[model samples]
Target: MSIHLFQISLTQLQGVGPQKAEELHALGISTVGDLIEYYPFRYEDYRVREMHEIKDGERITIQGTIASLPTMQRFGGKTRLICRVTVESMLVTAVWFNRAFLKEQLTPGREITLTGKWEQRRRQMTVADSEFPDKGGAKTGTLQPVYSVGGSLTQASIRKMINQALIQFGALIPEILPAELLEKHALLPRRSAITRIHRPENTLEGQEARRRMVYEELFLFQLKLQAYRATHMKQADGLVHPVNNEEIRQFVSRLPFELTGSQKQVINEILHDMKQPYVMNRLLQGDVGSGKTVVAAVGLYATVKAGHQGALMVPTEILAEQHTRSLGAMFEPYGIQVGLLTGSLTERKRRDLIASLQMGLLDIVVGTHALIQEDVYFRSLGLVITDEQHRFGVNQRSILRRKGMNPDVLTMTATPIPRTLAITVFGDMDVSTLRERPKGRKPIKTYSVKHNMMDRVLGFIRKEAEQGRQTFFICPLIEESEKLDVQNAIDLHMQLTHALPELAIGLLHGRMNAAEKEATMATYAAGETNVLVSTTVIEVGVDVPNATLMIVMDADRFGLSQLHQLRGRVGRGEHQSFCILIADPKSENGQERMKAMTDTDDGFEISRRDLEIRGPGEFFGTKQSGMPEFRLANLVNDFEVLEQARDDAAALTASESFWSSQSYKELRDNLNRDAKQQTEPLD
Candidate 1:
């Protein structure tokens, strides 16, 4: 009677023929174990109710006798069924749209039960679910699981299939979780949890099942991340180069303004990491105008002073050029040689830069992914820094690290992740935060407007342009498609160019070539182009101090962090900048999101609220980003579970024989299979 004795084949399920089995395999539900773990998205309750007590618009079940024979008719290609029933002398009408078969099932003078929403229309009590009493036996007071289904597989069909499978395999249930771990987490037995989740007798049972499964999923993911951190820390040892603050002090002393307290604190943290024996894999997270670049420059200066090279990798050529120009100006006074390399550079220029980089003549090289190309070699690479770390994957970051003998890594991001998520996802790296903006920087006045205010907004823009100020118009899409998003870059550029031909208008999008993009950005930055119309491609780079006006059309289509980044493009100058979010205020969610933008200028607050509303998976694109994707545990709604799971994982991994434990073995096998199964079909 061992729990592990269960070994039911999926083919044994009723109505699951070979073809259906193959189709299920395509969705990665090939075995009983996989099917059991395929959790439902939501649940439905089917508790019965008294006919007289049933409230209007409330879905319920009431027993009644048919007063009149049901009538079925087709109206405008849609079938409709209507019938009258009596419950204790109270007559109630039931109507069903597209359920004509119900007319024959509920005949006159027959006692039956109806389950659906009761609606009062034109002084008549009408019910919606038009089904007979015998077919209503599936009703349960507990939460009924609702799953995601595809073509031809309705919810009822899926429920029936799963029920059949469960019935056939019920006696063969297995206990996959270790007894100690289950007890520690107060998790239910695996077999009982799975059974209850699909067909719960009560709401509490269903909730307990969900809680247990969520904990298991999050615990396993945290364990994997913790194990990765532990393995990397033990193997990759970093050289601790003591920081000589003299060089950084000299550079800072010549600055026009004093560094903010937050900036100085972050620099101190970076300096401390540089003195540590472990490799400095740290993320410098700050708001838009928090001056993360200067902190990173300090790290570069310190690394160069330690007799090693540093490389700053940006996502685009324009960002690379901007970083190179700024860093060159900052470090040249200290005699630090900074070089720029990009894909758009001439062959001869790139070759010359590569030679200097190999010869160790370039102390710091700032560029795009070109810095990690095979042709470019670093002589004494000591530190590697990447801006907008989310744009690159782990393998790409590892490739850059391979340039040197385990170079200390420093990653920077303007998108401020929540503290809890940061600790879990980036547990391997130390973190530094710059929370304050530089002095004299004005907060951009943000407003949400509808399309009707387009003309007025343009007029304001014209005024700003006349005053020698620059403007940026951000569009959600690059080109005109048949989509609902009407304000695309191409169309908007044409409209604006025609409207304001007196001012220079330039276009920048992802489809444009590198040279074209760089040229357009350069024209805008140099004040040659007074207006720039672009897509989200301009979200990361193209910093212009003269651009004082920002307008994002259909701002509701953009994420909070993306909108914040686009807004960051402006307010870099002294003039009072404005961000106009043009969106339809009729949509509640859209209004709520844009209101968040208009209310606060804090990027971290926006990100936190975004995570709370949409969850971290959507905020960071964790599924596509190759980070651990959870099925049930949401970082926002299930915050407690996430924290507990992380703690449990840390404790379990700290044990000497943790990796050799039965639970760890199963978890590792599951992870390996998950990775492999992603490449090919399940079958």
Candidate 2:
């Protein structure tokens, strides 16, 4: 009756052999409870209609008498069973391809209810799979649940399995949701919901059952997130040194350029949170070229000025080196020392950097995951900033926190997330977004070109390279994949070399070692490489101001946010930047992305469209992005339910007596499991 019962093996069930059980397990259904909860994707109506009333091309069920004898015929390498049935007075021709066995079941004067698409022009139907109804059965007006099946399982096989389950284990079903909560939400009883979700007696029963399942999934998820938020907020921030307006003014004025209004507003938010008693768990989201680095430096500078150290962790060594150089230029003038520690650094150099940081001589350290190993120590660490935060897992971020006592964490993500997702996923942290681009920055012109236009695009790239500007040729794969039609970096590099032999070409991918990638990036950065062919490895970093053109091959293969990130690689300089997307995708989603990329340069708007097109799971790489997958609840369609559930969870968690209540024991256990199952920094 508890959660463990849900894990009972399907092999123990009747009519299930080892092979069938293995096949079922492949679909994530290895237990009796999982089978019961496997709700239908849609319903097929067996409600027989008049033959004359069946519309053309509509899947219909029609009842008729066998007025004519069934005949067998041979077609092009296939068998066909032909028959004529009289429905009232009209004759309908039914053709079942490769189903000569149906002739034995279709005897003269035998009445049958058939389901297939109607072809009114020829008065015939190519019948789909059909089965005979039971004696005294009247299923012509009922709905039959049609589940999504795979791995040698048919609808009938699932039905037989469920029928056996309902007979054997139906009486033992225990309610997971508390009775009071069920009453408040007007949800169906647990057993009835399970029964109707699989084999509903009518349309209304199925609808009610589905609603309850969705509500249960969403409510539990919300509860887990709320608990995490409460626990996170309880952790006290050890560093609360206040840097007032004068210090902030000095820091901002120290820069060569002026700060944007949005950037100033976000800094105020970060600074206020840092000065609070609790740690500042904040995600600083901004569009590309929106001056996030300056604001982050300001935050770190304030922490360092307060006589504490800081560490800025990035995903790539190239980006970390870039950050070290940029931060050093700004901090050097303020008498603050910045250290660059990466995997590529020599052992002696790394040890020296670590000793300097441990001795309090280094004001801030910028590096990759190399900053979090056992030997790397920081003295009085107050702030930790992670660039391209999503690239690192939640555990990776929290590991840095342990180096210092609840250091204020600031995670920077250039992907502009929609508001709904920010509230749901980042519920544990306060968010500050940089919305406006820096002054004098130009928007990159975008184009969605077909494969045939590559000649013109190649010509343009050559022209740009000849003008002393660089171009990036981005492919989705590192090597050519037979399964994926997208161009690969290795082949594209060769192709570009042959096409533009006068200019130098380079290759970059994630598979390359740190030193190899760094050297390749260095050559491209130094203007020695005119054309850089790479994968999404250069999505976040590899900021080359001279790189003004971006040509993405098979652009339709990427997510919208990824495409936008690739586009951000360019347009970092004063020259007019352009993005050429070469793709001819077959799906509607592909077409939508192509149009979105070519239409405008608004990251926020593009993300909103992306979220609408591909729900939360795909938008954020569900598991990898530190988000849980829902079995029933949809983030887009059930946004209101999600909000309501969050409110309910907050109230439930805050209630003093609810924790000790006997009725909520199962829920408490589930919450604990959910917590341990998915631990995230800003979940």
| Model 2 C-alpha lDDT versus the unseen true structure | 0.84
lDDT score, candidate 2, position 323: 89
What are the candidates' C-alpha RMSDs?
A: 4.6, 4.5
Best model per TM-score: 1
Per-residue accuracy of model 2 over 279-382 as CA lDDT, tens digit each: 78889999988989999999999998888999999998878988888899998878999989888899999989999999999999999999989998888999
Q: Against the unseen true structure, what C-alpha lDDT does each candidate score?
A: 0.79, 0.84
TM-score for each model: 0.84, 0.83
Worst 10 residues of 1 by lDDT: 674-683
Clashes of 1: 0
**Residue-pair clashes, model 2:** 1
